[model samples]
Target chain A: MSLRPYLTAFGLQWKIGLRYRIAVVAGLVAQMWFGAVTLMAYASVYHAAPDVQAPLSLRQAMTYTWIQQSLFTLLPLGCLPAIGDAARTGAIVYDLLRPVDMWNWWLSASLARLLGNAVPRAVLLACVAGPLAILVGLGAWSLAGPASLISAALALLSITLGALLSATIVMWWNILTARTLSPLGSYAVGTPLAVLLSGMLLPLPLYPDWVRPFLLAQPFAGITDIPIRIYLGTFIPGGVATGLGLQIFWLTALTLLGRLWMRQTVNRLEVQGA
Target chain B: MTQSPSHTLSGPGLYRRMAGASIVAQLRYPGTFVIQAIGNFVTTLLSFFGIWSLFHRFGSIAGWDIGTVAVLYGLVNVAFAVAETLGRGFEVFGGEYVRTGSFDRLLLRPRSTLLLLLGHELRLRPIGRFLQGLFVLVAGLWLAPHVQWSAVLVLPWAIAGGAAMFLGVLIGQAALCFITVEGLEVVNVLTYGGVEAGQYPLTMFGRWLRRFITFVLPLAAVCYYPTLFSLAHPDPLGMPTWIGALSPAAGFAFLGVMILAWNRAVAGYVSSGS
Candidate 1:
């Protein structure tokens, strides 16, 4: 299999993702606002009930939020916008005609797009929210360092796997877009499902005891929650290995299931002329 | 300026007709609408679950119980969903209209651009969020420890105000597009970010942040004061409860100011020579 075509697809998306420098800044500001509001709410809640043994300390939760906000773009919010535009205008016919493996082409593009958007924003936000914040007398609210050097290295590996898992989830959405010939459904489903299940709204560790395990078991958990715990060295039910294992597991399972789905969608697209 | 061919229909009347057309177009694919609506419902519900789980552990946050917080959550979500549905055009105006140079075409239309934009689509998807919010609201009312008939009277007022305030934010964002289409996402900070903040009592925020929402954005006027008044909860910040009944008017005031700004932006428009 020639990897050249896939590399080209990846590069195309990576450029498109990086082109919007101003949007990145604007999105960062919006995310920072959300993080600040959420942190304040957490502080109030934690203060109101000093006696409760919460799953995460106030500092841990605040750090969790800072990281989550910085990496907001990394989550699978929707299908590729190009796919959506194509589906809307019937330009998807060109995509169908491409002489390459459809799954790899779209998957590589999806991964590149997520990374291009996420990487810069995360770096800029972390710098501002971590060290700079402390220098500016907001140390109590700054993003803390990883629990240890080993944890930092492990978090690095886990986030890479997490990114792969997110891109795979996006592939499912792309297939859904191709199936329906509209992008709206993918977004309507994707945005909410990812935000909730990925712990963007609240850390998974914070959910009620009865539901905590189920949240951990879900595919979305692999995207962020598990990796965050590994960095913080917070308790995962079976510790860090389970977290890494879940990421690899979901990446493999979703890729297999998603590839099958993609093939089915392609067949249907052929049968129903664009 | 070209005269609207159908002058018999005022700007608002045209909006009604256009909105009705959009509703029909959307309903053409009822299945898609249903799925998106359900997705929106689930997304908000999941966030509420996050809140519920927190309360389960702590019993209350900032001296407020689940029922009161539910009202706040429901109010903000319901308001945002309504504003988003009506302001869909403004929300995407930068990318769709300005970048494509379509704003020039919009200007030549006989009808008011604002009305035309409002008519772009009365999105049904937010109905999912709307229903979920209403459900939580009713549940909150039932679950609350103290209730007077005043809630029924005040609920409509607060929703209208909150929606209007959010619509103001959207209009301001669209106006900002006139100068730079590149950095529009910052507006989401005041819109979506506002909803997140409004879900909690305003006192939960730090003093500076608290004042910004109150004096600048007026979110507290629409959401916090109203919730406090309805729940008979005292303002830990020492604000008067009577303000809730009247403060929603600030939403209308904010909208009016944004409308003036939109007019200026339209007047200053230099077509994106695309």
Candidate 2:
């Protein structure tokens, strides 16, 4: 359960990953190229129609897409497959036998992997988006500092919780069957639900009368949309407080669920005789 | 339930048997299959909603009406869904097959690598997306109230071509993974980014992007020009409607190039053992 062994494990994985350094760099470059294409498309669309709905101006939409592309680094959709693979291969048994708390061990491993993967990719994506952001004249708002920090923190929390939840599912079902559900859970259930409910996609005022309350009720909107709103200095008094409160609530709930699942699954561990 | 005989299959027949087995393996978990199909449908639907919402807000974009845009969306989705389903093997080749070196096993089989890979996985769930696309296409046709029988007849060819193009992108991605998995993002610019770009008319983009899609990627050949012809919209790019009608053929040519690249990459991998 100590941090030393976990850190060692993390370091080992990092080294192995580094051996394929070219592949990693290539992947980053490919992502940046697409990011550039996306920026260009957004710019073109904005030029064609200067105003895409009331609240979302050409600049804001471009900025929003940039931020979204950048933060996409923190998404946990990819982690579940790793968990599922380990479970399927019965490697979870070896992973669990290590003298570490199951949750802490897995979390550390994933965090290490994420750092190995996301950090470099994020840097590259930012480099790509930064020039485009400037070229598109994305304003350097005063709130960018606070908003970005908050968004980053939220993104990390969301990814961790998402990974845990996904890992828990893999513990029950192996990778082959889990493939379909995991992506659905991550993409269909988690990301968009978060986007829609968190109020990230549209501001509350812009939403129709019937949908506003429902959209506000979902926890996901708070993850990205709320931070963006705050960055834009559009957060009203009560809404900002409520959004932050909801984010904390969701994080706590997800963490608890993950822990419970991990404990139960580990207790029932039936490592196949390999 | 009677299972098919294993020994009776040979050569192309063996490949068919293998493909059938893979499909059956997927079908073993019908619940997962249904959920995944629904998930894909929902995700694709959300994208359509995004486009629809834009149309609702702006009435028209780049001189294209909602219905015309819907047709474009439908065509792209239909093509993409078919590609995602049939080309599931190629899509995962980089991450799953090439990364694990299972591609060598594929080569050892007494069948064309393409057939064996195509048979490796068949995603039935994207059928949900395909149906949604079909609905959209029909709706667009109804809304436009146009009946070009020739264009209608060529629709299948275009869809096949588009599928081939996307599949080629996936294959190319897998091939590049051999060289370096680092910049898989560039492939996304062609695959995922292409889907988004193809959803709208190519003329909506800047000259550079349009040319990239047309010459480098040939996406416009599959979707935009044929769409203009189908909707009776004048080609802003000055290409005749017949060219659009014939554009999907380019997709096959693209696939041919990718296959050659894939073969070379595989040969290099075999020699270098990287």
Candidate 3:
């Protein structure tokens, strides 16, 4: 499959998305406001109870929360509805007729979307959240800066993989389920699962002995906890490597599964050429 | 053979028709509704587990016992569920309807936009969240061993107030969508973030955060203050105990302001199409 056409498509999407810059800025402002409120809430709780038994310090927790909140926007919950709509309306066939491979083309489109939507918004959140973190005295960890960058990268990768997985599922399922799963599944399954296993709300060390193994085994942990742990210097360099290994493992697995689903559903494909 | 311009349905009749239509649509998908309800109940229940784990180790936070915290959590969920059931369409308006231009259809209808929007979707599934809230609320009563009939009478009123407050936030969010959909994440700070904030007593937060919730968002007026009155706890904010008892009324007032804001936003959309 030719890569140039996909790149061109990505560029087009990015330009289209960039047109709504004002909305993007507004979204960032809103995130910052909410982040400030949440950080303050946590600070108050920690102030009230300095001896809270979480693994990290109060500052670390606050920063971690900010990171999690910011990264949430980066994650692709599902854009299956768009895929389904395009397929249903006969756009998919037109896309297939293009020189680019379907998977690569879609990936390019999603990348463009991420660039237009998540990247600027996340940067804006970071800029706003940075001062708030400083004001709240939450940036005490020596590893925060490096950890945040690594976590953000990992978060982006995880979200891309997640979106692909969901898209593949849409290929297998009908459009209604695909559309419902993309949004609803992310919140119902993905986000909550991430919260539980990723140690977003609570640390994994705090869980009971038997539960830890099961929680760690889940893919959600790889999304936030492992990356955050790497950032906090909680994990040794080797541990970080292993964490990345696990993430890659899951990403590859999900991707292959998605591809298989896509191949199976292609025969049933109906699309509107754009 | 001229028609009277005043033949259209008004007030209660219009509301009843809208409400009936919404209910019918909801009933059309009873299985989906049941599954969604179960999902809502389980996810909400899981969040409480996080708090329960905290209590397991620390006993109480900020001099507030598990029972008291449970009451707060329960009330917040109950109120949010009420809002979700009534405001599903608006809750998803910014992301789903507005983004897709489906909101324009609502404008085409002769009914009040607010009424039609509210009636567009009613999620029976939030009944799961409501029931879970009821369980926690009863547990709080059981643990606290409080038996004030007057406070009991105020419970429904408090729920109503909380619902109004939550719905107001959703409306505010929908209004914001008129300007931009990019940074809509900020609204989560008020809606989901508020729920998290409301889960714990306001006293647990820092002074600034507390003041913000009290004076700015008036979240204190809905959950904390009324909780104190209902549970017979001291008024931390030092308002009259009656203030706690009557604070839910503030939710209605807040919602009223949001409605006006919403109308203004709709006007802006009509003029600018932004």
Candidate 4:
């Protein structure tokens, strides 16, 4: 009913997320290294198969790799680390006792955490990989920006939706952690699924033809791949509206389904113990 | 209690007993064990699919066919999984051992700390990643049509060496916790990031990077060179044919250096405590 608690939850989690300054910088270095490695791999693959007629050019693929790598923390890799900790320590019961909409409270907290971790790294990496690399005369290997002004605007809108979709998925992982009372399952299941399905492992366009459609339609694609494609000005078979529409559809559908699941899980937890 | 010389077991026997105990403790919860194992396998399998789709599309990248890359991918995954299975204790050492002051408990034991930690490495869950890697290795070997009896002998050795290298990385990460726990995650760049980089051929990278992995990290020694030798593929950079046979030793040497670092870190912790 009241927005105060949820906003407070958001603000608290955001601060916690930002506290790991060392981790953010360290993670940036690692991501940059891996991004460079992946870009090189892409360059070699594209160059080796010049006649293959891939959907994205080598430059577009390089840019995609940079964006994906920079935004690696943004992907729903697992449930909130705090939830995992609380579940382990039996402190999660306190979360249930709070006088707020549990779903919104958790959702806002999760979103704040995601954005808090991702935005700084994304900004720093964009500078280093995009403008800084260019400044250093490594423009060929640097990340190319959004294809056009309109493409940039749409990409910004879609990435916001994408972040929400990712957080929604993390909610499911959180609920799973709550039910299981162990953080291990969420990570063991969440990580590889997100990395592969989100096209963080490879550009969706680079996958085989039959698999491409499935990759495009999957909810994970809505997280990063669709937006990146839109940013790159690649022609989506059903166009940009369809891409944005799919993300919205998944966000709404998943939120509704997740809320039901959370309610049932809470009831089960209450009847027994978290 | 009276101790008898005749009742004293060898170091290997003690290690076996300790490892066996850990394995039994892990299996105490069969449901969670199975789920984690299966989850791990599925996760790695999905990542492999990313490669499968790539090969299915472009046939090969940088003159390395899918089969060759698969061999490299499988070997590295299998090696990393083996390390993860056995060295899980070391992997969590920063948070679980040092921060919790469990290292003091370990020091109180009569057995050497390295042996105790080594014994802790006999975890079971990584079998999933192991099985998936083996599947890919077999598939790659089958598809490649390169028949070499020596490869059978060489493959296991390469895996063992690679596992040692990764275990060494884990140890180095643990050592860093003595100074600061906050930034130990950067070590993941060497461990997890290494695995990702090792998935592709070293030749795919630039000259400087190729040299760094070969001479510095020595990934080329364990993964790239050995696979090249097995496939009988000539080096584009023309290092030498015999380099592959000797490269695994690089991993062993790296492990040796990490052990020295670990010793220094432990000593620092001991001195700082007073």
Best by lDDT: 1
Please write out the lDDT profile of model 3 over residues A80-162, one tens digit for every residue.
Answer: 33555664465556655766566666766665765566666667666666765566775542114645676667655654554
For model 2, residues B205-268, the per-residue Cα lDDT tens digits are 7677788989999888888877777777778777776687777899999989998998887777
Cα lDDT of model 4 by residue, B1-274, tens digit: 5768779867899988888888899889998899889988998888888777766777786778888888999999999999898788787777777776778888888877778888865889989999999999888888765646778978888998899899888888778877875237788888888888898988889988888887778788899888888878778888786778878988999999999998887777752231
Clash list (residue pairs), candidate 3:
A27-B183, A30-B186, A44-B206, A89-A272, A90-A271, A90-A272, A91-A271, A91-A272, A147-A231
Checking candidate 1 for backbone clashes, the offending pairs are none
lDDT of every predicted structure (CA atoms): 0.90, 0.63, 0.68, 0.87
**TM-score quality measure for candidate 2:** 0.78
Q: Residue A262 error for model 4, in Å?
A: 2.0
Query: Runs in model 3 with CA error above 4 Å?
Result: A9-19, A44-53, A87-90, A95-101, A131-143, A147-191, A194-210, A236-238, A267-274, B1-10, B88-117, B123-125, B145-149, B170-188, B236-242, B256-274
Displacement of the residue B118 alpha carbon in candidate 2, Å: 2.9
Please identify which of the two predictions, 1 or 2, would achieve the higher TM-score against the true structure. 1
- Cα lDDT tens digits, model 1, B1-274, are 4667665777777888899999999999999888988998898898899888888888887778888889988999999999999999999998899988988888888788998899988998899889999999888888887765787878889999999999999999999988886437788889878888899888788999988998999999898898888888778888888888888999999999999999998999898887
The candidate that wins on DockQ is 1
Error of 1 at B220 (Å): 0.8
True contacts kept of 3: 0.31
RMSD of each: 2.7, 5.5, 5.2, 2.2
TM-score per candidate, chains pooled: 0.94, 0.78, 0.79, 0.95
Report how far residue A169 has shifted in candidate 1, in Å: 1.3
TM-score of chain A of each: 0.97, 0.65, 0.72, 0.97
